[model samples]
Target: MKQSDQAVVFGKRKEPHTIIIARGSEIRHFTVRPWMAAFAGSAFAALAIGYLLATSYLVLRDDLIGAATARQARMQQAYEDRISALRSQVDRITSRQLLDQQLMETKVSELIERQSQLTKRHGRLGPLLDRAEAVVNGAKPAEGSAPAKPETRVELPSPAADTQLAYAAVGSAKNPFALWSTRNSAAQADSSADHADKLFVTLNQSLRTIESEQLARIDSLAENAYQTADVISDALESAGLPVDADFGKADVGGPLIAVDNPSMFDTKVKELDEALDKLDKVKKEAQRLPLANPAPGRSISSTFGVRRDPLLGTPALHSGMDFRAPMGSDARATAAGIVVKAGWNGGYGRMVEVDHGSGFSTRYAHLSRIDVREGQKIATGDTIGEVGTSGRSTGPHLHYEVRRNGEAVDPLRFLKLGKKVGQYL
Candidate 1:
């Protein structure tokens, strides 16, 4: 056994003692240096420092990890709030779209109403215009049987209310007017498409009708011209004048009529021929005659003469012609003129004064209704007023007066002149 130089403490020791131990074959020595105490204390302090450093590093890492987790949670919360805001915005946008759809539906309803009225107007006008054209052209074939008069009463459709169509589909409004309008709009669209197709078809038909009418007119004129030319040529041949020759190259004076013509027939014929040529020129120029009924259809109620008044036993000088017609009958113009006055007069009621060109003027009196206004240009045969028994009139009649250069003139001469014109003006 080896003995160590270690001090052993005894509970009953009175003095400090050093104990030594010896070994039989070997000795073991242990020395403690004074600097070793500092070394040992330093080592113990270093170990404690190392342990503290490790613990601090672990704690700091844990704190940093916890802070990072907390920061991530905050960012996630902010993103969730932003997502919620976006979702709210989307909800608002969807609500706006629904509102807009309702507005569009309202607008569509209004448009449908307007479209219906237009269609009705077009229908009435289209037929009226067609009839007017037919009458004017005299192109309709005569009917075999008497025609039945159509009912003149016309009914028009009204509009729709907003409350009636709030819940219905765009076209399913319960209102009769709305339903009719929607149907009419669809029908009109179909009709418009059909009209476009039919317009081409109708255009072709109208073109054919116009061409036929024009061709008929041309043919009639040609036939009349041929007959006239033939008659002229035959008459010239019989008279020993140039036959089958153009009028531009003809001579009538040398030997055909001779210097001794007792009847003066050749001279009259020449004059008549010249008059016919003038008439042809007038016809080509679309000249209008004085009136359709040149000698007005009314009865000759009064003449230009002195007459005794019915009310008073006094003589009065009548300066114009008076025509008696049914009250409210159309009173056509005597000639193309500008209406100078359309107002009441002292003795003549509802007088219409017209200023015809070439220093000529006319006056119409005792009218029930004045059709033409002052300063209006009226064509010959156009209705200027309606006949009636007005102030100073014996009965339903028209008092017409003719004036030339502002002087009262006899109307009989003008009536005779008007009679010479053709029927159509």
Candidate 2:
């Protein structure tokens, strides 16, 4: 409590002070400058300033880190968006290339098949055309001219499995059809499609030309067959033979529809078939009639109708003509027929009565030996028996007769008609 000590403790001084401490009852006293109170106050002020600086630094650092994280997130989002766009563009390009390649492959395969079909048709028509020409014009067809053998077919294009989503252009598959492809694969695919289109144009032209020629030939053949049928039918009618030719009775039908380019091959083929049927039927009718000579190269010794009989030695009605032939010479049938009466008869030694269809029949009589049996089928120019001097026969001779519905007919009539146009039948 001294006045000088109080002044010193409260005074403002630049030098740091040192102080001492005293306790109550121990009665211990010491110097008043040992404890450094000023130094402790300076250290406390320094600690308060450091605490404020640390708090500020912590808050500012948190804000800076948040801002940097936000900027980095935005940059990453932009990069992902760009990558997505690039991937979409790549997929579209690959799809386009694959489509082009597929189209080209399909077209080339179709063209090649069409050409092969045409070639096969040509081969089939060649021999048929030759025969038709020979029959119609009475001459052989020209060599290498009938279907002309189609001068070497066009080379086929190989496009098998060339178009794939993971593959490249037509000739080569080096560059993949994908986003990472560094080559111009899209352009190459387009070029292949263009080339296929060109081939289609050329092949279409060739096919059309072949179709036209084939259609014309078919028409000609049908016309010829129809004409032949008509001519033969008329000739058969004049000969008092039944004409039984039917062309339209054949079963022919199919689904019919209207179309821009209708195929004429089927229609033409049907027409030809019907015409041939008619021609064959008419020719068969003519052949079935007993029109051929029964004994060829034999001299007629007796005429038909009223004649002087050699064995009877009297004038009588002759039912048939007598042909002079050597003993045991073959007596042939004039028409195809089935034998109804064979072997010995009262007036005809060994007789053969053949029944042709349509109420027509033929008879070979006065044969020395019987060669044909009853109920046996025979063809024209078939041997029925041998000629000899048998019952009612003058010498070695064959008696040939033609009958229609059991009535006798002049054999010369049929022989004349058959000799004139037997080749047609």
Candidate 3:
């Protein structure tokens, strides 16, 4: 091959090149080899490519940043929405819980009120029962009658039962949010709500039980009062005394005024209270009635009715029954009354007349000594005089008379009635 051709095809040596620039009167020249020129071209190409890449990057920077920022904003919005949903759920749960709590509180208040009324009723009945027990068990003997025998008393429940019932009925509901601190979710809220509902149901059932027990107790008391009142009324009728008009069924009034709004249990309690009040009134009236024998441990010497008078020795109407008693034996008042007459009378000496209420009065005649004065208050079994023979009396004895509106009735009737009443006094 030719040398030139060979050099061109496979050059092993560098070739020189020159560049010349002329401007006005100045000239510059640069010489370079073929290899150096090629290197310079390669460097220029690399710089051009780098510049293009730098410019393209600068132009697209804002779009890239904008796209990234939009993506981040969308993600943040989605997170905020999720948080708002959770907050809404919490709010709903809280509102429902508040409503439930309010309802429970209202129910608790009602139960407490019922318990208070029941307790008050029990308090009133307790004393009345005690009084009845005393009356039935500690009865004093009637004058000129055998002593009363001791009786067994029915046992009553302890007062602590009432206190326990009050505590249970007034108990507060458990906290509905008790488990809120441990977990916060719809499931947790639902669980808490269910627990509250169950608690309220249990509390309501307890209140109902308490109310039932109270009603039963009240009914028992009312029954006892009714029975006692019936007995007292019969005794009063036998003694020829008028029973109180208020005790009649027609005179029964409405329920008592309540401290709060009335309920069925309250109405029942009020009725029981009214019955007890009537029974107590009857008891007091019975105490005031003349139903006791005037002379104790004595036998009737002269019976009331038509009989031979000891002084006259002829058929005469006996105004009173004469009790055979030792001289100077105590003569007690037959009833609680105010003494209206004392000292001597036409046919009797050292007599005492007691005016019981309700147009009833009693007289003790032929007494050796008068212990009671006029206008003096005396109770049953109070010493009013001393038995002796005086005036028209033939022996040491007491003449006792029961008068209704100043008219003498058979004294034996009252003495018999006294004997019957003394058994329950």
Q: How many residue pairs clash in each candidate?
A: 0, 2, 5
Please list the Cα RMSD from the true structure of every candidate, rounded to 1 decimal place.
24.9, 14.7, 10.5
Writing each residue's lDDT as its tens digit, candidate 1 over 359-393 gives 67888888888988999998877889899877787
Most TM-score-accurate candidate: 3
Candidate 3: list runs displaced more than 4 Å.
Answer: 1-195, 235-262, 273-288, 309-316, 357-359, 422-425
Instruction: Report every candidate's CA lDDT.
Output: 0.55, 0.68, 0.73
Count clashing pairs, candidate 3. Answer: 5
Per-prediction TM-score to the true structure, in the order listed: 0.35, 0.56, 0.57
> Can you rank all candidates by TM-score, best first?
3, 2, 1
- What TM-score does structure 2 among the candidates reach? 0.56
Better of 1 and 3 by TM-score: 3
Give the local distance difference test score of model 3.
Answer: 0.73
Error of 3 at 180 (Å): 5.0
RMSD from true fold, candidate 1: 24.9
Order of all candidates by lDDT, from best down to worst? 3, 2, 1
- Candidate 3 displacement at residue 242 in angstroms: 4.2
Residue 78 deviation, candidate 3, in Å?
A: 13
